[model samples]
Target chain A: MKALCWHGKNDIRYDTVPDPEIEHGRDAIIKVSSCAICGSDMHLYDHFIPTMEKGDVVGHEFMGEVMEVGAENKELKVGDRIVVPFTITCGECEQCRRGNFSVCERSNRNKSLADKMFGHAGAGLFGYSHLTGGYAGGQAEYVRVPFADKTHVKVPEGLTDEQVLFLGDIFPTGWQAAAQCDIQPTDTVAIWGAGPVGQFCIRSAVLLGARQVICIDNVPERLSMAEAGGAITINFDSESVLERLQELTHGKGPEKCIDAVGLEAHATRSLDSVYDRVKQAVMLESDRAHVLREMIYVCRPAGVLSIPGVYGGLVDKIPMGALMNKGLTVRTGQTHVKRWTDDLMNRIQEGQIDPSFVITHTVGLDQGPEMYKTFREKQDGCVKVVLKP
Target chain B: MSYSGKTSSSMSQSLGTSDKLARGIGWFSVGMGLFELFAPRTLTHALGMEGKETLVRACGMRQIISGIGALSDNPTPAIWSRVGGDALDIAALTPGLRDENPQKHNVELAMTFVAVTCAADLYCAQALHKRHKYPSSMVYDYSDRSGFYRLVADMHGAASDFEVPANMRAYPPMWAEFTPEKESGLL
Candidate 1:
């Protein structure tokens, strides 16, 4: 099997590794049909989140045909097409009952497939860390899925792999942002970042019935997509976010705001970190939260703040008083892609929305590392790049 | 859940409309009107459904603010990371991290605090000379300080790591203080 492994800072490489096989009752082995580079991969490409291993396969967004299924994976079967949810969970746990599957006590990831899969300590990801449930990611030709029945969603027959590939991550993540925002029909909602997730947040906001969807980003390609979708676009470099948002809202401000941009902080054309002057140099871009602080000022007194962006566990101090004073409602989390994917798929099937609009580039699995680099550096207008292995 | 009482037949009828335009563009207006009428964001905290009152927490995201807000149009003023956020000289504080040292490094706690703060999303962590501002700091903490592990208790219900809600964030010590501002402007 071949995968883009995270060796260290700026050291991601295309390397051949072992193939995958089913190892548990709720496990399955799937041949990769399609996969996409996620924004989070930037963490490794730039070394924002450092790891000790040089061979971590770091992708959670993928979809494919299931070649085999574990004994307990009865709900799913061999030959079934699936959009693999990034996390594994026992559908029967209390957390699962409540839909918090990521922290499922039963989740397991044998990154090396060197142990039990049913319900052992599974905290590594394809290429993340030994702590995140070290399960090899779908970036490879063949990947193992833990809790297969719960993690893999059968891609409804007839849906193209390209159409459903990102449903595993970006599409669902965008939907989660929109869903978590709880936008109303009349309420104006805004999204930060024009990346794939931000684009989806805009589309999903409109699909779910936001009165107005606004997008803030420096990337022209992303802003254009938002413009086509009827979302008002603004380039933060050329304008003031608070001023423009307040003007549009008559000072009452938007009811909902979402941060699709995670820790990666970039200036007009360069990346700036507290560490130094980083322009396209790919330092730990942790300034996205700065925009969140500004969002607090523009939001209506009782507005909702939704964060679909990823954040690491270690961080600086935060403003607690301001948030509490506004009586603001905040919903931030890793998108439970599985919880709402079926609903999103239905939306796609019914033509309520077409998430594939975010797809701007596609390539074979062999080009995974290069595409990932391009996507990470924001080269080639890569809002969302797709890969087929 | 936002339109608590407006269960009008027409609303359900609109929900059933065929055209994407009718379903989205059409219902959009009704949904907005009902949203206005019922103040959906004010209700439905317990709806256990998406797009409810919790949405307001999405403060100041740039994508959401583009061309429509005050700061969206302003050039962000530069703030040194050391000034805005950085290390706290543990030597100066009363119960200095080293003095009251646990096995973990205090600065490391600050790093974890920032990580979870950013990861948690609602909160933007800056340097604090005091710890009281970070009650929810542990909301993103994996530690069992407040049993917030149950916040995102159903981890499967969560998306990827980044999109998890703050409700699931670990609650830090109610009075955790921030690192004192860097002296002489050093990070």
Candidate 2:
């Protein structure tokens, strides 16, 4: 099977690897039809998140048909099409029973190592790093899905791959980000970053009834897309994010804030961004918290801050004083993808939203390497890239 | 597990020609900067300008800064800085090409090397600029991609039928009664 493998920092290769086989009774082999390059995958491509090894298959957003199933896996049989959620859950754990699938205690095979790093091991993630179980990803012709019976979302026959592919990751992630805010009908939601997840956050906030949705980004095409999604766009490169958010909310900061841009915030816009770059270059900080700082400083008192961004390791200079004094509530975690898939899938079926709107590039698996570069650089108006395996 | 250690197919690399060139230039800049910084007297003597050790060291510092910049995620500015540094290098060497200099041939050889490096730097800079910089005139219009089937105004708050999970709620239902309209007696 041909797969995209991570070689080193900024190095992804199209290489031939052996096909996967079922390893457990709940495991199944999926012949992948479509996969995507996610923004969080950029963290691995840039070598930010640790524990990635050479030749590791590098993708998590994929959907396909079951080619083989384990003997005891009664929930699925051959030819059942499904989208594999990025987070692998056992569905019988304490967290899973409580609807916190992202933190299912039994899924991570490397629980000891993760425990050492994160204090408690969360769910095992596909194609993310060893800290998340180091399972092989779905960016190939085939993949081995552990706990497949409970980790997959069955897609109906009418939907195209583009319309349903994101159910595995970004669609549910954006939905979860908005839902975590508990947005009210009269609330104003301000989102940072207009990439794929950010775009979905705008649409989700709008559909859930926020009176105003404002998206902040420096990319012109992304800003335009945000506008199309009913968000008032702010180019942080031109205008002030704080000033504009205040003005848009009539001098009272937004009631909800979302940071969709994670560790690799662009370092050219503000003094804090420059400071973060210097700290990162000097090995003093592991993640840039500029968006986090800006959000803490500008959010209205007692507002909710929902973060869906993938932040790995440490961040310095967070405004703890402001966050405490303002009585803000912060909610952040990996998306419990299964929890929102049923609702989002219904929305897709009912003609409420189409996930394909974010895809701007599609190509063969051979072009996956170059597409990673194009997507990471945000060149050629590349927003989301889908690879047909 | 049917996985094998051997790969049966050829590998496709992520780095392109221009990317490789930029990386090579970055390493070259770093190496040259270190050499000049550590052995400025050697450089000044080789160029027949024996008293300019401090100036040579300053140029080395400039080279190192540009080199680090070139090695960063965005190398366009760093490569351009290299081009500027190349001009300064040529200007500094011109005085060493005087008729009275004993090492005029070495000075000429040094100038030739700098000129070649300058050309390479210019090419890499332009290529990186073209590859990374978004064209100001080419604006992509994605305004039609609302993802909603109906108009946004019609679809706003359509998901009100769904309830926010209890644990994720920001505040209790009683807080919802304190709306600005209600506080102002409009409701």
DockQ of each model vs. true complex: 0.01, 0.38
- Most DockQ-accurate candidate: 2
For all candidates listed, what's the TM-score of chain B alone? 0.16, 0.75
All-Cα superposition RMSD per candidate: 25.8, 5.1
Candidate 1 C-alpha lDDT tens digits along A1-389: 87767666545566788888778888888888888778887766666654337777778888788888888878887788888877666777776777766555567434333233223333334445655666677777888887788777777777787667777778878877787775555778888887778877776676666677888988766677667665788898789777899888888888888888777656443222333233223433333455566567677766788888877533333456778887777877666767877776775675555566666667666556556545665545566777767
List the candidate 2 regions with Cα displacement exceeding 4 Å.
B1-12, B97-105, B115-137, B172-174, B177-187
Model 2 chain A, poorest ten-residue lDDT window? A362-371
TM-score of 1: 0.63
Error of 1 at A45 (Å): 1.5
Which digits, one per residue and each the tens of the lDDT, describe model 2 over residues A144-170? 999998999998988999999999999
lDDT of residue A353 for candidate 2:
92
Clashes of each: 121, 0
lDDT of 2: 0.89
lDDT per residue (tens digit) for residues B1-187 in model 2: 1111112231145665566788889888888999889999999988889999999989998988888887777777899989999999999999999999999999999999999999999999887766545555656789899998899998899888878898999953323756889677798
- Give the alpha-carbon lDDT of every model: 0.59, 0.89
Score residue B164 of candidate 1 by CA lDDT: 28
Can you write out model 1's per-residue Cα lDDT over B4-40, one digit (the tens) per residue?
1222232211111121212222233234335434553
